[model samples]
Target chain A: MKHTLPILIRKEVTQFRRNKVLPRIVVMMPLMLVLVLPLVTQMDVKNISVAFIDHDRSPLTLRMESHLAHSNYFRLCEPVGSFEEAEQMLDDGKVDLVVSIPEHFERHLTLGDPKPILLEANAVNATKGAQGMQYALQTIASAAMEKARGRGAAIGAEQLLTVENRYNPTGNYRHFMLPALMIVLLILVCCFLPLLNIMTEKEHGTIEQINVTPVGRLEFILAKLIPYWLLALVLLAVAMLLAWAVYGLLPAGAAALVFLAAFLFALCISGFAVTIANISDTMQQAIFVMFFFVMFFMLMSGLFTPIDSMPRWAQGITYAFPPRYVIDVFRSVYLKGTLFAELWFDFLMLTLLAVVFNLLATVTYKKQS
Target chain B: MDNIITVSNLTKQFGSFTAVDHITFAVSRGEIFGFLGANGAGKTTAMRMLCGLSKPTSGSGSVAGYDLRTQGEQIKRHIGYMSQRFSLYEDLTVAENMELYGGIYGLSRREVSDRVDQLLTALQFADHRDDLVGSLPLGWKQKLAFMVATVHRPELVFLDEPTGGVDPITRRQFWDLIRAAAAQGTTIFVTTHYMDEAEYCHRISIMVDGQIRALDTPAVLRARYGADTMEQVFYRLAREAKRGD
Candidate 1:
């Protein structure tokens, strides 16, 4: 009786547990995202089909074909007789690349004047096309170098640059996506769940009854937000567990730092959602408004891509997104092993957004109009 | 009996339209006040202002001894309100709904639990306490809503179209509960479209086109309008209106 917040929180939690779909979704969504999405959303391109037009038909050409065949990057088609046939294969989508070795390819290599081989690629799928072509060029260059070295050409191993990838040494896309996917989980749990919860009460006419009660607006809003914030944190823990169990990916930095970032982001997003709920009277209005903003936040917040690579204007807009700050915290903490000192700016931005959104929620929520 | 509600010249305007135009009335302790009106006749609007759910555009009033304009939160604590729409959470069980409203009104857990038990037992639906309110029939939900509204034992309670669609038998049962509340000195301010129900009120006020055209006991109102029934008395006044619906 002293405080209604605890009772209100209990009601929300009970309703959430009793919901038919929400409980199931809360459990299954993160599991699916952690277990399944990593394998599919990978940026590492593989499984390219190359049709070889071996006009030279020399041992070097055969060796090149064999080398391409042996490599995991390219799958060889039956050697076509002409470029037209190989191009036809490319057009039919049967092959991604067409390699036409010239007639004097091996002879030119012996003369130390290697002829340029024609590499035709279907550029419709740009990343696959660009990466496939690059892999083919490297393979052919190395094969040509081996032949050149056999002829005593002065191409020493020291001439090639040795490159080393730091942090994520193997560049596993799953390791990168694990943290980003956790952020997506937060958006769904903290943002959308609280929004839908409030909208449901409005639609059902329950909020009207609550308005007539002696409860303070701040108390009511806190009641609405507390359950979702707790839920999002629990889901984050589950996601982290799944990431560790399935992908063997754990946060490279303090796990507590990752949780602290999640807590602030949950506060920001759930408050933002409740603010929108306060403004909107209907579920349709709330959903569309939230959808428009959440789409912008998720899409442009560098969750799937790097903000540094985006246009300057779009990158500037990303700074306003709360998700952008949290994503930075999560990625740096997970991949770069960044500490709280280095990530204080992102943490500060998230705290600022949380304060702003929660203040908006409280001020906009009118118990009596 | 002391006057429990004292509202004078309470007016609410929405843009160019006047929803509640200078309505004034008072209700004594333990009196059953019926606020009857046609569709869009502003009964709900006036009730909202009295319940502190909406602010009057202009006027001075007091509900349950609290200033309607300035002391809304205090007014809320001393009064109960049931909206026309079914407002009890459908996902919550019957006992849960009761406990929630009771807690919101600052009732202790033991007090809420005891009252819930008493109410459920009196209604002979103690077994249904664990059942969701959605699973209950409409009439039962309305009855439960009324019970939940008065769970805190406020000095005054407002019911907006409490019985819109229900069987006659159930409607009578609802009125019986109302009578019991008034017998214990709770002032009842209820709005309804049913003219027959108006006869049960200690006094009735009929509003048409944002103005109260009649306010008196049903027997006195009928005699004043030279009509035999309360329905005839209502038609005589309502027929003069230009606004419909």
Candidate 2:
């Protein structure tokens, strides 16, 4: 049994090298997921278009328009003569938001009787609509405050509130998603690939030849797992390097902590994958079954969305998912510089899951029936 | 002659269906034992039982001096199995497949390399040792599977329909390999659809409806049944079977 493991793992490596698609995917997935996908998948909305209707043609309203145009959040369209024209642009999807300054809007304001500025937003996409409207309101309010200050009138409410974002100072969405993307790479390489390898053996009838030998079940399962485990780590390292090189993102904590969590995650996920493969008789069945679980693992494990934002029952479901814990460890260590002392519970859960799922893999595989 | 395999009242059932009913047999060491039957006659099941690939429903048996019920792992170490389906890894090179199986049986790297060399030369394809098994012809694949099965030099090897789809010339060549293995003191327990192949066996057992209908040398069975050929002798018994598949 001791001698059999290396031979099996070597055989797996040879087969992986010969396989045309798997090796290419290993090379391509990290490059695409790390170097390219982060730039595309940012959840923070930007590039909103605004059309301004200046009725008073006052200096204050023109300053407000310039302020909105200069802000990173909004772009200005050609000036419209009336509210109807601005609304037409919104209806045609030409602009995302419309701001109308009423007639004599600056005369009333200088007399200390302010007229409300009307802002209409195209709410077809709720996020763009709501966020674009909020940004326009803030820009216009600041412009009005500047006008009042020029006349020596004091603004009192500005000092009432201050906001500071934690961990990520700029609230960059890519920083939050980079660690989750590494977990995605781990799942595809460790869990998905090994399950497909085993299922392919079953489909081709090659496993029957191995089962007839005196090789122990643990030895065979470990042999299948070890190569992928090492490959997943290498892929993780490549992804981390790419994250730093392309996005200038690196773990704030000890890099070893991230690797340790990933190591445990690889064992846990691959063992779970093998158990699924043992129960499925064909590649199709195994793939569909694995797809179902992986979809849940990626979507519900806080890779794309926050677990804390999920409903009580939905968050409860994530506790059973091993990826959820490791993803937490990845995000905390990468963004917050969380130490192992603060992450002991996550490590314990990963270890427990690794032990349980691998035991299932060894027990469920039958040499004789 | 010492028996390498012995079984009494050995049976296997899948639910209410008895795949291999109560039967008894034994094969002495180095003998080329033929298990002949029509489709689903339980030949494969019986061979699987003796090879320790499946548990018997109820029986007492031993293979390679290991108890079938208690020492399955020990039995596995002393024997090799080639299933009806082609089971060699198709993506691997010829030498790699041989080395892998040899290594699984605990052969040292030196021993596996030596065996791979011997096999590549003996099979007369030393030049193609690095060729992928998938690229080889089907007949060659079957032969390579048989060679890899015995790479560890097991005392006994079970071949279940090893020549199912090959042409007669290839089948004859496959049988020659079997005869050579037996000559080297490796017991061969095999199943074949062709009765002419049965003539090459030292002794053949005819199975029908999960029971051994006749067991003897081909000549003796033909003579006893008053038939000119083993096919006639097989038909005379098998025509009485209630199941055809």
Model 1 lDDT per residue over B119-139, tens place: 888778899999999999999
The best candidate in terms of DockQ: 2
**lDDT of predicted model 1:** 0.90
User: What stretches of model 2 exceed 4 Å from their correct place?
Assistant: A53-62, A78-89, A99-120, A137-163
* Residue A93 lDDT in candidate 2: 93
Flag clash pairs in model 2. Answer: none
In model 1, how large is the Cα lDDT of residue B63? 79
Q: How large is the interface RMSD of candidate 1?
A: 1.1
Model 2 / residue A24 / CA error / Å:
2.3
Residue-level lDDT of model 1, residues A239-343, one tens digit each, is 999899887888899999999999999999998999999999899999999999989988899899888989999999887899899999998999889989999
